[model samples]
Target: MNQSSSQSSNRSLPDSEYYRAFLDRDSNYDGIFFAGVRSTGIFCRPTCSARKPKLENCEFFATAQDALLAGYRPCKRCHPTDHPGSTSPLIKELITLVESDLTRRWKDQDLRARGIDPTTARRQFKSRFGMTFVAYARARRMGEGLKTIRSGERVIDAQIDSGYESGSGFRDAFSKMMGSPPSGNVAHTLKAEWIDTPLGPMIALADESALHLLEFVDRPGLETEILRLRQKHGLAILPGRTPITELLESELASYFRGQLQEFTTPLHLYGSDFQKSVLKILQQIPYGETWTYAQQSEALGNPKAIRAVARANGMNQIPILIPCHRVIGSDGKLTGYSGGLARKEWLLDLEKRRKS
Candidate 1:
């Protein structure tokens, strides 16, 4: 809880040891010390990939904020402020339970049974996954069920295997999500893969052709979009790896880490011609800039279609890759973003930071 190293004696190991760890790119020294390079005016994790600076130019700080306070910008390459491995032990325990029993419907009572406070569990899970623990468990179960169905199990059997109690409820839910009954054809299945990011968890929908949906797991109407995709494409959603899914996972990891600006994944976007045009224009909004709806409409040669442009932006299924968040209001304020305006702000701030 000490704010400054000067206030806390014996804060870090010897500076000489930290320098040696930086030279060797030892991850063990990651959060222990931040390396501020006087020459580059940037602070980095000890394990940063950027070339090491001269010892005289390198100043070690106990925390990232300390380096920033000393007028050092965060290294875009290293992202010293983030530590993805710092998930709480309690969350780890809960995740294990969810993975072990994909058929079980986890609830607040379940956390209480495990000696965990429901409120604490929900807050931590929401912070890490951008969804409640119960929602994460539901996604896990759906992913498992999709896998079971894709393995040639009968629809009703797959429903039971997925932990559904009533056949009618299962069929209704399956129809809502899949846009059709569980089919015998394995080729009709679309892959549903979960990708984790610093922002939150994202669910990627893809097939052999291209990625259809890439949205944050907590986004409202996500289930509806999944159903729409199924009905439009006549495909069932399942949990598995596809070439597109694998490539997207890699690309998304890079994108979230500030390593990549542009996404090259092919997309199977379904929409009216106007909608497709709007999204295509969105992709051209550049990496670190935003455009207003009026501007986007003007770019489409229909300056009067400002509202239409905004509506099309809202209908975009693929969010980040399509860059709908880059579209703002004419007043230069952030408007509606399906992933929440906070996330919109975060994405913009992240891009601006990387640009700096």
Candidate 2:
């Protein structure tokens, strides 16, 4: 088939605009499009380091799946299917350091001692993890302290071991995170962890029984959602992992690789009865297929509840497992997705390609 015939039907922008982005190797367009070279039958990300092709030989696609289905092999030089705007080497190195020593509180001086710039670290960490490196380190330390206290160690000892010298400082930080002083009889806690995917870093929250929340770190209003969860459940969210979170992380890895179609991780959904019903129908959307809001409302036996159905989808705290991205507008155009329209498009394309 010719390049045009094989191109994705969902291309939102003109070919000229995509070509300009490709020529510039713009990181902003990295996940937005793939340039398929007719001459080489190879496709690459917009920020691919490989040499650009002539305009006449190029066709643009909305997603990696689109390019692959269009009969273009992924360019080995860029590994378009592997990494989008490949995670920075600095981010990888710093994360390695933290994982090796979770309880070690990282300070600006410690970063400088390692010849790393504190300002750059903060900016990069904020961009990637949605928090400063120091904040992330502190959360790790607090999580460690929580574990120590749960292990029956004295609260004071846990504080000292966590690198806090002043008693008030330790309690203040601990209380702020756990919603209660370390010495209080805090019986239940929800552990949260950052799970990295090809798309981006996502925050997963869970207790012992079920996964509560999983969302992209960069999603708007994410902080407010977390706060609401904390308030609603009366649980302190610490940076750690539980059985449910670990299961979710593994399932997510497999799902992204297109090896798993259905999610088995248990979930504890929090919502109104109508919202809960709406989410249940969303799960039945069938992998690789989509349903319009009208279809969803009809399924609910209330054809006039389209707006309500859309609102319920917007309020979905756990996205992928609940399959909120499968819903679209009646016009066949994508609707509002809290994870961003690009992600919605990419996810739909993934499911469509894998299903076939």
Candidate 3:
């Protein structure tokens, strides 16, 4: 943080150390520079492009916010700012640069022509975003593609418009995402991960940073909800798993086995605004007690949203962590969950057992 450290930090690290970290997706450097992968047309933090980068091609930057300000975008999984790079003055510049030209593909040659050292750009990006520029760019494109899909555009169109060459190529890109085929192939969609828990094996999903869903298979309404998610996201579930899901397995297992009371891991909550509002209230419910929908609605300041609140509970993507099971009916009956009624009962009883 001193002047010499600042000056040295402005210079790029040797490719050996710089690109290696990008390939590794090391989280310790999330606020570092961004890497833009040429092959994928995405930019990432130094911690991204997990597949590795060649010595000749790796670009370095001192900040992801800078690389992004240089017109690069964020890698989905290697989220730089949501982790803390936002604390820098450079992050604001990156936001403007990328948002201004999201459609333009970034290239190292382009940087060099502009008097920017692409390799040094990698160091800067790695220093901030935790990856090189190209890695971040590719992730940004994928994100736009998902948004396009969510907006009711066709996947093929989303792909072509986003800079990919074909639907197969798009599918391959998505495989790197939610770990599933396109939702059109529901039976084969790999939208979530299933893990063993002390209470029972549970299924969970995420795009990268967010926890999409976490529930017991036997829980009521889970199947239908999964199908709904498929149609909504135009994505299928892939067989891949993320560290968050692994953590979810361990934490929920401990919670159900009656050994833990709090969950601090990150959660991916995807839904409507109402659902999000309901989730915020649910997260505040005490671990040992429960709240009726009437109580929850009252807390949210919308007495009429009680049923809406229940619907949001059913729509919750991160269950136990969000603690939707804590919401009850006016009659004190455990309400609906994408997970089964029986599992809800089991979880409630399990929490009680732990409290006792």
Question: Which candidate ranks first by lDDT, i.e. highest?
Answer: 2
TM-score of each: 0.56, 0.54, 0.45
The number of clashing residue pairs in model 3 is: 78
- What is candidate 3's lDDT per residue for 259-328, written digit by digit as tens? 8899976875668787788899999998778899989999999988877888877777677898888887
Sequence-dependent TM-score of model 3: 0.45
* lDDT string, candidate 2, 39-143, tens digits: 665788888888888888887876654453333555767766445545677766775686465446678999999999999999986765356777655544443
**Winner on lDDT (1 vs 3):** 1
Deviation of model 3 at 184, angstroms:
15
- Pick by TM-score: 1 or 3, better one: 1
lDDT-based ranking: 2, 1, 3
- Identify the runs in model 2 with alpha carbons over 4 angstroms from their true place: 1-187
Error of 1 at 125 (Å): 17
Name the regions of candidate 1 deviating beyond 4 angstroms: 1-176, 179-188
Per-prediction backbone clash count? 0, 0, 78
